[model samples]
Target: THSGTSLGGGDDLGAYFGLGTATGVDRLEVRWPSGLVQVLEAVAVDQRLTVVESGLLAELRPLTWPIEIGSAGGSFAYRLGVTNLTEASVEVDVWLHIEGPKGVSITRGPIRRQLGAGSSLGLTGSQNVPGGAPSGAYTMTLKVGTFPIAEQTASFSFSKRRGTGRAEGGGCRPGLGRKL
Candidate 1:
């Protein structure tokens, strides 16, 4: 059995079942805490399997304007839409990460929210880009769920305006974004 402690301690949550002289099992059933059930047939033995829940969908939509950065800094805003495809309300965690040129990475949140069945929620926010950041392509990634049930990415670029000493660029280019 898998167990844990509530007193700020750690426990191994892994479950191991030994099948003597058996090469495989006929079926496996997993009942999630959220009341979702999954079944696997003809399962192979002696290997670790990672199962991810698939009751949510996420999409990332960046503003269609160029990101303008002045001497001090600038901010870019985006909208993330999440949909619950299940029949019941489910709680999930959302995370946003901005990765820029030269290994500059910024994390926005692990915001937790609950979505009703067949309902959608839009999360809007902005992220600050520091002054003098490298001029190049950047990527914004959105991840949803406690175990990453869905993910999407959007791309943008930053370049110095000719003779203006400022940086400006656009994301959400046509056919540039993709889901993962």
Candidate 2:
């Protein structure tokens, strides 16, 4: 009613709304000062919709991940892929929690990054496994922007087959990856 203590012009005197974590909106109704009503339906998220003689409606989309599994060690890197669908850009913070054999657990940082609007990002980082670490299963969980994204589990077993001329694993050649 323009009776509030707002410093803006008459354009800011209308109604405002906010929706959190909602996927879609079925219908939105608006009433003008001239006693005319307008309704909009089937609106999608992460978009800016304009209405004639009415205010603007906006929606935000959440982040998504494509490749969820990866191998982490000195010879290979842990990869992450994220997709942003919102109209504006966003920053993604990465964190890691690793559970190794013999009840060992490690926590990594809150790395921050800026993501473009409606774009995807792929990043890779290395992880260190101690030489004395037992040969067993290892788990790595990833968190994007402080939210848990995905978890990858792999078995770690090392052996020396260079002298015998027999490879241990498939699709991987020895001395091909980054050395420690």
For each candidate, C-alpha RMSD in Å? 13.3, 16.1
Candidate 1 residue lDDT tens string, 98-168: 66777988765667778899999775655555556665667676667673433322334543222235433
* Residues 1-180, model 2: lDDT tens digits: 465533454445544456799898876666667543444545677676655542111111112222122222222344455555467777665555566566777666656657687766555444444334444555555545433422111122222211222222234322212321
Residue 126 in candidate 2 has what lDDT?
49
Candidate 1 worst ten-residue window by lDDT? 171-180
Task: Give residue 6's error in model 1 in angstroms.
Answer: 45
- All candidates' TM-scores? 0.53, 0.39
Those runs of model 2 whose alpha carbons end farther than 4 Å from true positions after fitting are 1-74, 147-180
Clashes per model (N, Cα, C within 3 A) = 0, 0
lDDT of each: 0.60, 0.44
Candidate that scores best on lDDT: 1
Q: Quote the positional error of residue 62 for candidate 1 in Å.
A: 1.4
User: For model 2, which pairs clash?
Assistant: none
**Error of model 2, residue 118, in angstroms:** 1.2
Clashing pairs in 1: none
